[model samples]
Target: MEAWIRLSIFVAVLALMLVWEAKRPKRSGRVNRWHRWRSHLGLIVTSSVLMRLVVPLGLTGIALWASEHDWGAFNQFELPLWLAVMVSMIALDLVLYWQHRLFHRVPWLWRLHRVHHADPDFDVTTGVRFHPIEMILSLAIKAATILILGVPATAVLIFEIILNACSLFNHGNVQLPTKLEAGVRKVLITQELHRIHHSSVKRETNSNYGFSVVWWDWLFGSYTDQSRAGSDNVDIGLREFREEQRNTPFWTLLLLPFKDK
Candidate 1:
């Protein structure tokens, strides 16, 4: 039932974004959307299958198990349910923020993560493009965080939903009005900020690492307010992945981490 709810929401948000981008696309004419969507959708499907096979219990299950055994910090104390839920969600977000940073800072992990950055264009589909190995490792990290924090199952469900929704929202090719976007960026990561993260320039690529909230990037000093070439003109994707054939294929994306690029 929980899985169904998440899936339903995911489909709804993705469909909405698809239409939004179609009408108010931030940039276009770079690559064939059909080709890019094929690879992006393939990565998402492949990673989802691998996750089900490897972590069958999922993050919320881990939280429920911890609660049953009284095995984690929240369970060990007498905190209010609301307090526990709020803290757990914040902590989970913080952990993921660092996890994203580590993936970029570490050379080997970057190989897998670059599968995401290698998308020649950014859109709603690009939000779901992640290497299977990276998704598995992310699942492990999230599960461990849930266990240690004694996050309530409800909180885990909420956090996962918000996280997934934010990924699609921030990565949307549709942009907000400048004034509204400026205000939005003060809170959540807007598409403009995330777009800079996909810039081919190393400096821009390394900044704006937060996936949901903008606070982490600002607090950690990784924030880049604007792209060097301006938001619309910022060169997307890695320099090494300039050729469309090199980056936009299902098999190529799966084998990308092992390649010498």
Candidate 2:
């Protein structure tokens, strides 16, 4: 049931973003949409399969197990269910925000992370384009977080759904109206901010790492208000990965971390 809920929401958001980008793109297309989508979708599918096989119980399952064994902070003490859920979600988001920063600051991790950044375009599909090993590592981190926090299964479900939706929404090629974007981004990381994160420029790429909330970047001082080249003209993807054929293939992404350049 939890798997079905997550899957249904993921498909719905993905389809909506695809249609939104088709009708109202923020930037002109840079690469063949079909080619990029094929590779991006392939990565997500492969990652999902590997995740299921590696951790069949999933995060919610881990949370449930922790609760059963009274194995985490929340379980050891008493808190209102609502408070527990809210605190758990916030804590999980905070840890993930730091996790994202760690990936960029650490060299070996960046090798794994660059696969997501190596996309030659910024679009909804790019949101899901991550190396499978990175995905596994990410799951491990979240599981460890769950074990430590005793996060409620409900909170885990809600956070996972929200995180997936936010990724699709912010990575979208379609932009909100200027006024709307300004207002929305005060709380959420809108496409305007996320596009800067995908910029080929090193400084811009390193900033705006938050996927869901805008606060983490602001608090961490990694927030870049505008792209140096201007948001409309921001160069997406890694500067070194200009060759689409080399960067967009599944095999290439799988082996990218091992390559020097």
Tell me each candidate's TM-score: 0.98, 0.98
Estimate every model's Cα lDDT from 0 to 1.
0.90, 0.91
* Clash numbers, per candidate: 0, 0
lDDT of 2 by residue, 35-87 (tens): 78888888999999999999999999999999999989999898999999999
Q: For candidate 2, what is the lDDT? A: 0.91
User: What TM value does model 2 have?
Assistant: 0.98
Can you write out model 1's per-residue Cα lDDT over 145-195, one digit (the tens) per residue? Answer: 888879999999999899989999999998999999989999999999999
Please, what's the RMSD in Å of model 1? 1.1
